[model samples]
Each structure stands twice: as C-alpha cells, then as structure tokens.
Target chain A: MLTTPIPDAAETRSNATFDAILWALSRPGLPRNLPEPGEAALIEALLDRECAAYAGDPLLIPVLAQSGARLVDLSEADHVFFGRLLDAEYLRACRVGSDLYPDDGATLVIRARIGQGATVRLTGPGVNGVVELQLDGLPAGFWQERARLIRYPMGFDLLFLDGDRLIGLPRSTKVEVL
Target chain B: MTLASLTKPWAPMSYGFLDASAKRELRRKMVKAVCVPGCQMPYASREVPMARGWGTGGLQVSLTLINPQTCVKVIDQGADDSVNAASIRRFLSRVSGAPVTLDTLQADLIQSRHRIPEEILREDQVLVLQVPNPEPLRSVQPNMSIARQMHGDADYGRMWLQLYEQIVRSGRVMQGASYPSMVNGRHVMTPSPIPRWDVPKLHMAKHLTILSAGREKRIFAVPPYCRVEPLVFDDVPYRVEDHAGLTCSRSGAKGFFMNEVPQDDGTSAFELSDSEYGVKSIRRAEGDPVDLGDTWYTNGELTK
Candidate 1:
C-alpha cells in the first residue's frame, strides 16, 4: 500500500478555490461560495509563470506578481481583473480572441453586487433553460456593450464577484437584458 | 526578502506526481474548456512519466483533480483489466493514495479510452476521455490553419457534404467511431472515438465529460445539461452497432455492447465489453449481493 500524501495549506486553498470556480462556470448565473472573498484566491489557484495577467485593481498587483504572472496590457492578457468596472467602454478593449482560438478570449473578473441591480436572462449551454440574474455595479449599457463585443465562440467570459460569492458568464451564454 | 523565506523544504515527489505549477496551468485551461462547452482549447500539454499518446492527457487531468478522498476508475476499450487501464488505475492510487474502484457506481472520477461505461453516471461523477485526435475536421481538411478558419466561419458545409458522399457511395454512413456531433448547437466536436451506442449517452448527460488529447495539445469539455446532437441528414437516422440481441457467453448478460470472439466451429461467441459489469453480473448470478446501477441503455434501447 502506498502512503497518502497530505495536501498542504496552498494546495488545500487552491483546490477549494478551483472547485468553486469550476462549479460556478459549469452552472452559469448560480452563485458559488469561494474559500475566500475577492480575486486573490483565484489568482493563486490559476495563475503561474506561463500566464500573462492584467489587474486594474492596485491591491491585486502584488498578489499577481507573487504568482509569477507577467503583467501585461488588457488586450494581451488572458486573465483581466477589474476591481470594479467603471466605464462600459473598457469592454471593447478586452480581447474576444479569434474564432480559431476562442480560449485566447480574456476571463474578466469584476466586482459587482450580484443580487440587486439590472436583471438579465441567461440561456446557453450550462443553463437549464432560462435563468434570470440581477447584477449591479456595471455602468450603463454594460450588457449591451458585452453583447456587442462577443461574437459567438469569440468573446470574453465574465465572473462577477460579491464578497465570497461568484457567478460566471461564459462566452457561450447569451445574456438578454430583461 | 530573505533567502530562507523564498526557499522551502524539499520532498521526494510532489503530491499526485505533478508539480504545483503544472496543476495550476491545467486548472486554468480546464476552466476555459468547461466555459466554452465543446470549443477546443489549446494548452501546454506537459510531459508525464508515460508516453504522450498513451492516455497522458487523461492521466494529467485525473492527477490534477484527484485527492485522497477521490475514488478513481480507469478503463481501456471497455475493459478495466486491460494493461493500459490497470496501469493508470494503479499509478493514480500509488501517487495520490486515492481509493480505486472497479465499480462505476462508486467512482467519483473515471478515465476512459474509446468507451463510456454502460451505466448512467451521476451528477457528481466526472468522465475524462483520452482522445487520440481531437479535430473532427482533420479528415476533410488536413491543414489545421484552414480548419480553424472553417470552425471560425462555422463552415461545416464540407463535413455535411462528406457525410452525404459516404451515403451515396456506401449504403449508409461508414463512419463508425469518433462521430462528429454538434455541441450546444454551435461547435462540432469529436466525441473521442466512442461507439455509436456511447455517443447518445453524452447528450444532456449528468456528468461532466472532458476530452483531452496530449499529443495534439487540445482540451475540450461537455458540461452537464449541454446538448450533443449527432450530425445526421433529414431522411437517414443515426444507427448504433447491432449488439443488443447478443448475449455474453460467460456471464449470460445480454442487451449491452458485446465483443465478438471467434469459435473453432466457424461461429462466433459474444462476451460483455464492459469487464467490470460482466463481473458484477456473474457475482449476482452466484447469489452474491451486487448493486447494479442504472444503465444508459435499457434492453438495447436508449432510455428517455
């Protein structure tokens, strides 16, 4: 019999964080509780030397650096973290990737009030049928801008963070402002 | 920062046999793959101890997701006792000390090559399929660059034309395995060379299915509740192998996928393809307690 190796602190935290993120993305619009609030835990679980990241939030810069991800501009970065979205125009600059390599599309993590804002309906792969979600904090015309930017199989994914809660909206999901 | 703070204690080997950085890279790509749901995503397929094409992609995924609490099952061409499946199952348990099971019902993670289990998977279980070739358009379009453009344009006219040509030349669709199916009504993905019977099980399945090709350096996913419609023409319906009427000579089990064995009398005998299921059936026949989970096919027909 082989002896079992115990997971360390870092491994435990990363595993839990990834579980939350995976479940959140698999079931879009449903909130999953992260091990810790905010993007720091997310960075630790996903980023490494192989990744190029962009963090608009100054507080997260050191955390991204610690993970050894190169800080690059929003267009080149695969993972972009905006502490709080200010202007809707920033969505235009985010890379939608090519139809060939849709994975190049950025994963945008932004702070938002998940339950109390503009209501939208989600219908796509992960969704059972139509799921209604309310999100606040994004600027006016945010959903419209997002719809305009994404061309199916070539658009950025969004993860709304509210303290310990996270909701994922993949490029496959069609968002309708209701 | 002090040097002592930067450096840490050394271990004989990393847990699960992969370095932390490799796991993180795979985790990132997995999230992206699941997000797109049938869109092929490229990743830096890291080298494992095994050969690149010999189930390394599925092994890496299983390693990354495994913990001491996970129950893992591995199968090659429907048999749990095959050399490839046995080695992978042992390797997984040896590295992470995760419990290993031959029963599909008890498994939390299943790594398979060329076949999905006959039993219906639960919502909590995950299925990892080792893919030899991930590109469904490779046969029609050899150049990957042009194929990428076709996928981008959603130009599947040639694929349909090819299928139509096969029907015109032959009496029916000649393509047997790795059947190209549309996912979420958008991307057409190769379902990893599983038999026609196994393809329908993925349509709106309860378990998450990840198809990874280590040699090709691609990863894709089919999340639970996603649609996976097999590409077919209007008049001609998709057909599975005619194995439902055959019975396993050894276990006396019938109505599942069977393996044809040649007999000396110029006839053929059939045996259960899913070796573990066959064993469970034998055990139950002997009056031993066995709990057979619900199967995807009921008496040779897919259950609605």
Candidate 2:
C-alpha cells in the first residue's frame, strides 16, 4: 500500500513511548517528522532473527551481511520501516507469511543505534519541524542502503534514531536527502 | 459535524485514533494470513489500556478495521451476558457506536467463545475466536523453537500418535478442547475449544477466521477457502467425540459439546460429568455413535 508520508502509526505507537512522544509533542512549531525511540527493544528483536528482509533498503547489505542475516527482498512488504532510525534492539523479525506458521525465515525488528538529528534534522511526513535521531558506526553502504529501500508510495518506512528519540519517515514521506 | 455532534453519544467514529502503526501491524499479519493460507503471525502486541483477558487484541483489531460503517457481535459461550463479551461489545459499541447483535444472524463481526453457534456463518461475517493459547505445541511440547521448527517442517506425526495412544488406552479420543489440526497442510493450530464439530467448519470456511490469544500474546489466522484437516492416518482418521449417548439436560441436545457438571449429592458419586441438558436428549432418542464408516474404534463396547 502506498502512502503520503504523514503516517499516524509511529506518531502514536512508537515503542519507547515516554521520550519519543515527549520529543515529538515538544516541538509545536517544528515540523513533526521526528524518529521514534527505544533502541534496546529493537535490537532484541533482530537478535531473535526469525526473519530478515530488504524491503527496498539495499544499504542493509553491509549490516545484514555482517550479521549473517539472510535477505528476504519482498518487493511487496506491506509495512515498511526504512531509515537510519532502526533501534536494532526491540526489533524482532517481521512476520512474512501466515499466522499458524509464524515467519521463521527471519523476522526483521528495527532498532536505532544512531539517528539523523545529531548532525542533521529530518523533517517531513508527520513532522512539524525537525525529528531528532542519528546512528554511529554504520556500514559502508548505510546511506545507499537506506536510499535503496525508498520506493515512494510502495516501499517501507524508516524510524531513524538518535539517543532516545527518532523520526518516522515512511517511503512516501518524501525525504529531501538533505 | 460539530463538536457536540461528534461527542453526541459515544464512539470515536470514523478516522479512529488507531493511527497507522497498529493497523499496519494488524493489516500486515492479516494480509499474510490471506496470502500464506493459515500461518500464525507473531506480531508486536500493542498493550491496550485494558487488562489481560479483556479482549484487548480483539478490541484493537476492531478499532483498526471497523469504523462507523461496521456492525459488531461479541459472544461468549453463545450468550451475550458474559461480562467479558459484554465488556468487549460495550467498548466497541461505545467507541465506534456500532450495533451489537445477540442473534447469530445479525452480526458482521462475530467474536466467539467455546461454540461456533448452531447457525451457519455467512461470508460477510468475520469470525474472531478469543484464544487464550494460540499454540497447539504448548500442550504436547513446551519448547517454542521445536514447535516453530515442527510447524515449519509439519512435524505433527507425534500429535496424532499421542491421540491414537489415548484411543488405545480408553475407548475414545480423550481430547476435549483446543483440538489441534493442520491448516492447509501447514501451521499446527488450536481450532480453539469450539468443539471438534467446529473443527470441520474451519475446513474450506467461507469467511475470514482470525484467532487472537491476548494472554498468550499471539495472533493467528485461517483465511477463507483454505483446507483445514485434523491430522489422521490412512488407518485412523480424525475422530469426533462420540460419547455414545451423551446430551445436555437443559437444551435436550445430544452429540454436542457438553460441559462438566458436579452433582450436589450427599454422597459423592463419580459418574459421567456431562451437563444435565445433554443427558435428557441422549436418554430420549437413544442416539447412537457415528462409527467412522470403517470402525476406527474397535477395542471396546460401543455403548459403554
């Protein structure tokens, strides 16, 4: 399903509820395109490694290959989350198939190690100003991988994280790459 | 619509506050259910403000999918008076102000417990089973890794052997509720204590069948038009409880799902603990067991 970037999900249901919501609500005048929070949980999800997918993010090659996580490049992955905002902790593998047999192929859970706002601010989609988040010690193809997953209106989304906060930029969110 | 009109009665109405993440999560799993046939989606269960066993999972789904346009029915043990069912129905009716149905014929979304209703469900209706435990593997084996691998590889030969062994020891298959089955030759799931009779209904069912276990914290589905077969062998097939001549006392119905009843006698007499309604019907007509055409149960007396 294609979108216009103003996702209502992450705005209300970010994992780390306290800081993420506080930060998003904190900026009344700023564009509300900030990342969600809680990296620890996202990381735990990935470590579970029940599924792994390249929803459209090619830059995931370095991170995925390094982690020995297989690639399930489902072009039709419904709920896409692409951005440097991955928590890598709370993230568990995404369910790819039916419920009876939960996707054991490798579920993809998102975690944020670093985010965009440390040096840059990401604002678009549901943003009022700038969403704060960043990632550090990323793979060589981080930006390229992040860009690769962007198939506007059809690709997944991203939750770029910086310490405790992150921005949710779905594929249709129209990132300026600024 | 003015603010007064919007808050006129109850319900969040159209454009519910489910946002999108929760919907996406639910929808993602839902779509996968349609795609892969009958697999359980281990979703990121969102904690509803409601406590456990409160149908939060079902409420969340209803909030996400149903708006002003939907009519919902929530039943427990085929009755609307059940507090859990009523609470859930009230939540949806108040939040979405959708109509509630006590009759099986009037529901658009039927959230059920224990029974599938004697009435046939229509295609327009979406049946959601309130599951306390989604995994059939939980009963036989506790390890999830093994269960996951078992489901992935369809290693349910053991489940069948376990039941068959019970039949050997006793005269019948000793399974009561949460009978396990293979949905589309994959994904071993609990057909949710809806009776072995309901088990057959799941096979090639017309409407979408979604099972949510909030306390167990997992959601699974069986898509429409998929084949769900109870595991059996060429020699021994799926056996429904043929309690010979059992019936419910109040309803005068036999060969139905009967709940246990403790008799209030001065001296404790351990007899068949079926509901009183079950006994009346079975006693009236003297209903006989439906032998598996080929006599699957041959060891004991048929009427005992």
Candidate 3:
C-alpha cells in the first residue's frame, strides 16, 4: 500500500493562496484573505518558467526572477504586477487579447487600498446584483479608461491587493464610478 | 541564487501526484476560466494514471485543489459507490490524504460526472465537472477554426436553427443530455453530459463550478450568481426530464431526479439518482437522526 504524500510548507502556502485567488475571482467585489501579504504568494502559486511576466515595481523583480518567468514588456506579458499606480498609461498598453483567444489576456495585479476610496458600483456575472466597493490609490479616470479599453470577453482581469486582502474585477464586471 | 535556495529536498512524489509546474499552470488557467465565466480556456492537460475520457479533467482540477484539510466527494452519474467513483475517490485519498466523505454537505470540493448534487451547495464549496466535449458548436460546425470564430462573434444562430429543426421533427427539443446553455449571456458551453434536471442547479447558484475536458484540453467556468440560460424559442419553454413526480422505490424519497430501473413486469421502477441523499432518506425513515441539508429542489420544484 502506498503511503499518502504530505504537503510541505511551500505547497501548503501556494494552495491556500490559490484558494483565496479563486474565491476572489469567482465572486467579484468580495474581499478574501490571502495566505500572506503582497504578491509573493501570487507569484509562488502562479508563475513558472513557461510564463511571461512584467513587474512594475523594482523590488518584485528578484522574486519574479526566482520564478524563472521571462521578464518582458508590459504589452507582451501575460501577467503584469503594478506595485503602485501613479498613472494610467499602463492600462492602455495592457494586453486585452483577441476575441479568438481571450485567455491570452493579461492578469493585472495592482496595489490599492480596499474599502476606503472612490465608491464604484459593480454589476456582473459573479455579483449578485449591484455591489458598491471603495477603492483608493488608483489614477484618476481609471474606471473610464478601463471601460474604454475593454470589449466584452476580451479584457484583462484585475486583482487589487491591500495587505493580505484581495479583490478581483474580471472583464465581465461593469464598474460605474459613483 | 544558490542551489540550496532554488530547490527543496527530494521526495518520492509530489503532494497531489502532479508536479509544482503542472499545478501552477492549472492555477493560471483556472484564474482565467473564472474570469471569463463561460469562455473555454485551453491548457496543457497533463497525463494522470487514469484514462483521458474517464474523469481525468475533473481529477486534474481536484488534484490541484486538494490538500490534507480539504474534504472530497466523488460521484459518477449521481452514484457515490459506483466502480468509477469509488476508484477515483480511493485514489484521491491515497494520493493526497484528504478526508473522503460520501455526504455532499461535508465536501469542500465535489468532483462529479454527469450530475450535480441535489443538495444546495454552499458558497465556500467548489464543483468540478468532467466534460467529454467542451464545445457546444461541434455539432453545428465541424471546423474548429470556424467554430471559434462563431464563438468570438457570438453567432449562435446556427445553434438556434439546430434546435428549431429538432422541434420541427420531434415536436420538442430532442437534445436530451448536454443541453447547450448560455453562460453570463455571452458564451454557450456544454455543462458536460448532465441531464437537463441538473442544469438549473448551476444557474445563479451559490457555488463556483469548473468544467474541464482532458481529451479536449479545454476548461470553462460558471461562477456563483452567474446567469445560465438554456437555449429555447420565444414560444417554447425549456423542459427538464419527467422524473420530478417519480418516487424512489428503495428509499421512499419523492420529487427529485431518479434512475429508472426496468422491472420483470415490463414496468419501470425508480430510485434516487443521488445515492447519498437516498441513504440519508432511508436512515431518516429508520428513525436515525439524519440532518438533510436544504436541497435545491423542494416538492419537485426548484426553490431559490
């Protein structure tokens, strides 16, 4: 009889991080707790040598490098990490992917304060109805720019990080700045 | 980075039978699948010990998600004790040491083939479905490239025409299992080969559902509270199987999906399709204290 394999510490952390990420994405606008703070857990759970990633924060470069993902330009990257947003130029450059293959769209992880800034209403598939969320530290007109750039089913997905808290906004969500 | 920092101590096998890289890839794909709701995302379906078409897709997802803390439940066509379900459950437990449960209420992750549980799944639970064919456009258009374009364009007119032809020929929609449903009002996906009775349980439900096809190398999702509308004409209504009124001969349960068994008298007898639910019903009838969770169907009708 084969003995059951046990998960090491790293495996446990990655699994928990992914569980949180999946939950946050499945129910948009809801806040979920990650295994740890910041994007380290995200990189550990998602990035590998097969991925192309772009890091906006210099401090995250070493961590990304350890993951063995090819560092590339913002447009070419499938996963892009923005530590803090001072401008909205990167949103325009982000890959929305083509209609034929929307999975090619980039997953953008940004640092922001949840529950404390501009109140916006979200209505989408995951949302039960209209859910209002307060997000801070984003550039001015972020929602408008996102709406302009996205064509349904072909837009990039967003993950906002605040310490250990996470909030996901998929392309299907309609964000109305209130 | 030094070698010691880059690698860990060697083990006989990975925790869940898949290497770290495979799990990472699946995690990325799953993120994208959840983001897009019904859009099919292609991924590298790594080989497991099982055959391609025998719930390998669901197995892969379950393996990626399983840990020692997770409670797992596996079902094949609603029966928890079938050869396929039993072997898969035993293999999962053996590989990961995750606790196995026959009760749906206790399961954190439920892997099913051709049926969803009759009990209402909580918000924290995840449902992984095994799909043989992920594409709903295959029957209408054989060319995959054209089919992809049709999906991109949301050109489901051909799908409607096929249903129209079916109704014209049979006086009702002839597509029995794997009924095509619109997800998030954007993409049409085959919710595996589940009977029509199980499809509504997915629509706007309180759990996350992921459908994967290992042979097809496709994965899709239906997030909680997402719209899942079955294709139907304006004049015609979507219909489930006529098993709502049937009672289980063995468990004495009524008003739920059932399996029809042929009797010696040329008549058909019914038994509950969800084996665990039936067991609970039987135990309750025997005066045992069994706590049955609120089911999706009550009195042969979908409530909430």
Most TM-score-accurate candidate = 3
Candidate 3 clash pair list: none
Number of the top DockQ candidate: 3
Predicted candidate 1 versus true structure: per-residue lDDT over A1-178, tens digit per residue? 4575777777777877887888788888999999889899899889988889999999989889877899999888989999999999988889888878888888999999988978999988778888999999999989899999998788998899999999988888888898
What's model 3's lDDT at A68? 93
lDDT at B117, model 1? 95
Would you give me the overall lDDT of model 2? 0.51
Q: Sort the predicted structures by DockQ, highest score first.
A: 3, 1, 2
**lDDT (0-100) at residue B238 of candidate 1?**
92
TM-score per model for chain B alone?
0.98, 0.75, 0.99
Would you list the C-alpha lDDT of every candidate in the order shown?
0.90, 0.51, 0.94
lDDT of 2 by residue, B166-251 (tens): 87999667776778887756567887777665677777565667777666667767655556777666676676655435544554
lDDT of 1 at B161: 89
TM-score of 3: 0.99
Order of candidate numbers by lDDT, starting with the best: 3, 1, 2
Give candidate 1's error at residue B163 in angstroms.
1.6
Please provide, for model 3 over B1-304, each residue's C-alpha lDDT reduced to its tens digit, 9 standing for 90 to 100: 8989899899999999999999999999999999998899999999999999999999999999999989999999999999999999999999999999999999999999999999999999999999999999999999988999999999999999999999999999999899999999999999899999988999999999999999999999999999999999899999999877899999999999999999999999999999999999999999999989999888788898
Off by over 4 Å in 3: none
